[model samples]
Target: MMQMPELLHSQKNSLFTAMNRFIGAVNNMDQTVMVPSLLRDVPLQKRDPDHGSYLRDAEADMYTYYTHLKSIRNEIEWGVLREDQRRKERAANTAVNAANLEAEGEDGNDLEQLLQYHLKGLHGVLAKLTSQANNLTNRYKQEIGIAGWGQ
Candidate 1:
C-alpha cells in the first residue's frame, strides 16, 4: 500500500504536470485542449466506500490550483514590470548625469552618446514590456471570467 506522503507527492506531481500541459496548450492557442484542461474535475465532498471520488477531489484541487497559479503569475508579471521600469529609470538618470558631466568638461561626447543610446534602448524595452504585460493582464482577466481590469 502507498503511504500518505507518497500519495500526496504523486498527486502533486500529477497536478504540476497537468498545469504545465495546460499552460503549453494556452501558449500554443489550442483552445480545445486549453478549455477542457482548465475545467478540471470537481472534488468529492466525502470519500464513499462504494462510489469513486476522483472527480470530486479533482474539481476542488483544480480550483485551488488555478487561484494560486493566478496569484503567482500576477506577482511575477508585476515584478518584471517593476524591475524593467527601475532599470529604465536608472538608465535615464545615468544619461542625465553623463550630459551634466559633459557640460562640466568631465566626460567626452562619446561617453555621453553611449549613455544616451542606452537610455533610448531602455525606454524601448520598457515600452515593449508594458505592452506585453497589458496583453497578459487582459488574457488572465478573460480566462478567469472577470470583466476588463480598467486597462
Candidate 2:
C-alpha cells in the first residue's frame, strides 16, 4: 500500500501553496535567482586603468562559475556514455542468450523443436536490433566528440 505525502502548512495559512512555490523556484536553477543575493553581498571596488588584478572577488566568481559548470557538463556527458555502453552490452547478451537457447534442441519432430526454430528467428531479429543500436550509439558518440571524462 502507498501513502500520500502530507502537505505542509503554516498555522496561519491553510494551504501549502507557498511551500510548493518555494520548492519549485529552488529547482528551476535559473541564475537570476542568485543575482539579487550576489549583488547585495559582493562589493564592487574600483581599480586603476592599468592594473591587472581588478576586482578580485568578481574575477574569482567568474572562474568559480566556469570551473563548476565545466565539471558538471563533463560529468553528465560521461554518465550518458556509460549508460549507453551498458545498454549495448545488455542487448548483445540478449542476442547471445537467444542464440544459445535456439541451438539446444536436436529433435526436429518435437513440438519444442518448432518453438526452437521460431526462437532462432527471433534471435536473428534481436541480433540485428542490437547491431543497429550499437551503431547508432557509436555514431552519436562520434558526433558529440567527447572522448572521455576525467581520464
Candidate 3:
C-alpha cells in the first residue's frame, strides 16, 4: 500500500554525486606536490624513486575507484532486475486485490525511468573521468616534453 519513499532516491543520488566528487578530487590531486621534479624532463630511469611510489599510489587509488564504480553499476543493474521480479510476482496477487496492489492510473513503470536516469548519470561520470584521464596523460606527456616535443 505504500509507495516508494523519495528520501531513498534522493539519498542514492547524493551518494553517487559524492562518489563522483571523491574520484574527481583524487584525480585532481596536487600534481606539483606529487612531482617535485617539476619542469624537468627526467626520464623514468633517472627520475626520483618517489616518482615510482607516486605512480603506484595513484594506480592504487584509481583501482579502488574503478572497483567501487563497477560495484555500483552492478548493484544498480541487479536492483532493477530485483524490482522487475517483484513486479512479476505481484502480478499474480493483483488479481485478488487489484485495488490495494495497483494505483488508480499508475502502471508502476517508474523503475525503468529511474534505471535510465541512473545509467545516464553513470555514463556522465564515466565521460568526465575519461576526459580527465586523457588530460592527465597529456599533461604528463607535456611535463616529460614528449607530447609536443620538437614540434
| Leading candidate by TM-score | 3
lDDT of 3 by residue, 66-141 (tens): 3344454455435535777888878877775576536554455865776788877866776565454444444555
List residue ranges in candidate 1 displaced over 4 A: 1-107, 149-151
lDDT of 2 by residue, 38-118 (tens): 333333333445885544445433324333433443443355357778899889999997787589754447657777777
Clashes of each: 8, 0, 0
TM-score of 1: 0.31
**lDDT of model 3 at residue 54?**
29
Candidate 3, TM-score vs. the true structure? 0.32
The whole-model C-alpha lDDT of candidate 1 against the native structure comes to 0.50
Candidate 2 stretches with Cα past 4 Å from truth are 1-110, 147-151
- My TM-score estimates for the predictions, one after another, are 0.31, 0.26, 0.32
Local distance difference test, per candidate? 0.50, 0.43, 0.50
lDDT of 1 by residue, 62-125 (tens): 4344444445445534554577788998999999987887787765677789877876665554
Q: 1 or 2, which is superior by lDDT? A: 1
